[model samples]
Target: MTNRLVTLFKFGIVGVANTTVDAVMFALLAVIGVPLLIAQVISYSCGVANSYWLNGRWTFRDAAREGNERAKLIRFLITNLVVLVLSAQILMSLHNMLGWSLVMSKTLTTLMGMVLNYMASRYWVFRLAIK
Candidate 1:
């Protein structure tokens, strides 16, 4: 239980780092006149890349087996792609249909997407092989 908690804490810390990457990239793109959706997509892609590296190396270090890093990266990209699409849709709906601020909409969608991403990555993308 303690070990699981530690893992979760590490994951959260890594997530915070990823969030900063995403937010800063998004803001920078927006300031340079990028559309909200486009800026979000670019920023989210950067965050996904960051998350894949940090989470695989640090958060789930024990779960990373002696295998091809490329394969793991592909799996990570596939998983995050699904989350990204869903999150984008949610953010777009809130920002476009409901007139919510882009920042607030992205924040809400990101929180929801984070839960789904963690579950999918832990159980499906990076699960340890059982003997």
Candidate 2:
């Protein structure tokens, strides 16, 4: 496979791990009476943390410019913040307004977030530096 395709494949692997962390955390929190929005935030944060570390170290390692860990982190945070707000709103709308199950709502939001995240991470947060 080409380099870009390889990076994308690695990203998919990391995404699976991140999603597992997020879904499990969210389910645990929500099952124990935590507020839905709060649970979503907490769980998404867990996933974001995982995404940053793994994507930086593995998926985007080749593209990463050296000595800019802090900058990359800041960019990752900004990207994820945008993703979180959108996902949370969608989750709420699906569950509360449209009478969807929490699982279904979360699944939908997660998928949407995955796409947004991959784009932002590839083209912005972890953009390849022009040489």
Using lDDT, give the best candidate's number.
Answer: 2
- Badly placed stretches (over 4 Å) of model 2 are 22-44
TM-scores of all predicted structures: 0.75, 0.74
Backbone steric clashes in candidate 2, count: 0
What's the true lDDT of residue 81 in model 2?
86
TM-score of 2: 0.74
Each model's lDDT: 0.84, 0.88
Error of 1 at 97 (Å): 8.7
Ten residues in a row with the worst lDDT in model 2?
Answer: 122-131
Extract clashing residue pairs from model 1: none
